[model samples]
Target: EDKTASDLFKHYQEIFPHGNRNAASHRWAHFVLQRSTQMTPGKVAYFFASFCPISGSPIDPTPQTAIRYESGHGLPQVSGGQAEGIIHHCCWPCICDSLKFLRVDTKTVSTSQGPHQFRFLVYGNPCTDPTRIPAEATDVTCSNGRLEASVLSDHGHVIVGMLQDNQPSIGASSREVLEA
Candidate 1:
């Protein structure tokens, strides 16, 4: 049994066999967990929860893949009670495609001196937006006071580029090593 497969998941050995789950996957999960805890510094449990804030899908059980994000990064608070800050989790696909999740509004207003550009980042209703952000979907872009909506758009493009640079190997290898 892999030592990293904690006691919490011991009973599910068949689903997460020793050979399939590798060090890289564990390292990635740990890095995400640590970063998440550092950012929120509260509510660490949400980091490991199987829920994906973006797609609302159950994440892979073994060698879980997750991207952590803060709540105000672009998520709607229908109840109007959501704290601007809280950690949330989502899958890689959701993180990679986050630019689409946002609704950007820009208007140029005439000020006393000149035209001023106002940019707004709007969060769509989760039910209507095809791209939903996981509590984790905040992506690295919005962490540590990087809460600008432009960051979300720029970061998503960067993520896509990184994935493309890695290409078939990164995707195929992660599945082969992490999937049960």
Candidate 2:
């Protein structure tokens, strides 16, 4: 017999045992997808716990912040001639470390001013260690002003992008890595 959403929900509740419906459903989906595609265990597990396990928040992406270049040599200048970029937001201090993750990538441009930069960071799920930043990365400084990071992740064959803001109103983006 075909399983309905309710049936899937019931199965998830049984499998999760200690989690809520949302968490259970997510886990179940992850398990089924992993099994069906014969994906590696490490990648499957990584995908399942990519976001915060408890609060479902993306890992904080505030590690390296954008550098405010007075000369605007290598940065993306906005209409106001301001360079915007991404920063890492550490979650271990504020929230349960078990439920945070992050990832980021940035590009900078050189302007007549000096050096300008733009960055993107992703938070929640798969908490990233900024100190151990991946290779081929550009760092941004975030002490002077607010910054933002755009995140990209691939799941199955889908590429998803999200914008993480670090201003007065900072939060997660609703974007997900789904097949196009």
Candidate 3:
């Protein structure tokens, strides 16, 4: 988001004057510029803080500070009859050095033709619960994360991998999943 046209142009120029920005190879260079926008809407239902699960660094800053994390991981868990988001310390620098996945989980299916292997789709988004922090690793806590999704205006507890995007309501055919 911080990148400006000049910053991108400089990096582009380094090779562009030598590499054609366009397909006008016969004339040495040709170019086309393009741009687009994306909108991912999320709201903070509540606000809370605690240490990052992965790095164990105390992150609930006194001044409510936030590290400029290039990215982070969220694991959703249920506690006290409520759903919670557990923040993993997957921020930039630590992410570069840490092991993102401990193991590869695969599902094997036997069909009439042969055995097919399918990978699990794990969708993890930033936690929207602001007031609840995950119990520390050693604090007798449930750190297991699972997927959860819901459509606009749906206030139901959705099971991961069960609901499709933009579903209008809960129904009997929730188990009918589509393959990606």
Candidate 4:
């Protein structure tokens, strides 16, 4: 648990000489082979939930993003040598944080059931694109902001929301300590 990010990165590098996220099966081998990691079940769960912007949610898995950068793109520029950016696996927050670090203003919309966040490319200054926003980007929403456009709802009309009967996260512990 005390292992720094650099230590974990080194461990990954040792396993993946090429990279952690190649577009082929070679990268898959490392993830499949290294089935047992130091992360506990609770720790992993908490780690995943950290990516979510809010509480009370349905399962939503996002497609993994792959990016390849050149040497001049904030990376070391090697003379003549091919610039190999470190391809890696990233969660939602990791992606958003990186963009924000580059001065991109990212926004997250939170509601009763879950959250919604969007990203876009801006022209002048580093900023977020309003047109390329999340589906539930609007503040005035219905059914936890999970409703589709086909379903029409009047603002004054009443809308009902449901809760799941069995969900472990409903009463999970705040702390993710290892159990003996």
Clashes of each: 8, 47, 7, 0
Q: What is the C-alpha lDDT of each candidate?
A: 0.28, 0.28, 0.22, 0.25
**For residues 1-180, could you state the per-residue lDDT of candidate 2 as single tens digits?**
132224333444344444442221234333334242344332222233233332333333222211112222222221224333222222333222211332233323233343333232223332233344333222211222321121222311111111223332223233222221
What does candidate 3's lDDT look like per residue over 109-134, in tens digits? 33333443322112222234412434
Question: What order do candidates take by TM-score, descending?
Answer: 1, 2, 4, 3
> lDDT tens digits, residues 51-117, model 1?
3333433343232342222333432222332222111224455553443443333333233334433
Query: How many clashes (backbone atoms < 3 Å, residues ≥3 apart in a chain or on different chains) does model 4 have?
Result: 0
Taking the tens digit of each residue's C-alpha lDDT, what string does model 4 give over 43-158? 22222222221211222322222223233432221122232222222333433322232211222323223443311111121012334434443321223333221111122111
* Higher-ranked by lDDT: 2 or 4: 2
Query: Which residue runs does candidate 3 get wrong by more than 4 Å?
Result: 1-50, 60-65, 69-93, 97-137, 140-180
Error of 1 at 46 (Å): 2.1
Better of 1 and 4 by lDDT: 1
Every candidate's CA RMSD: 17.4, 17.7, 22.1, 20.0
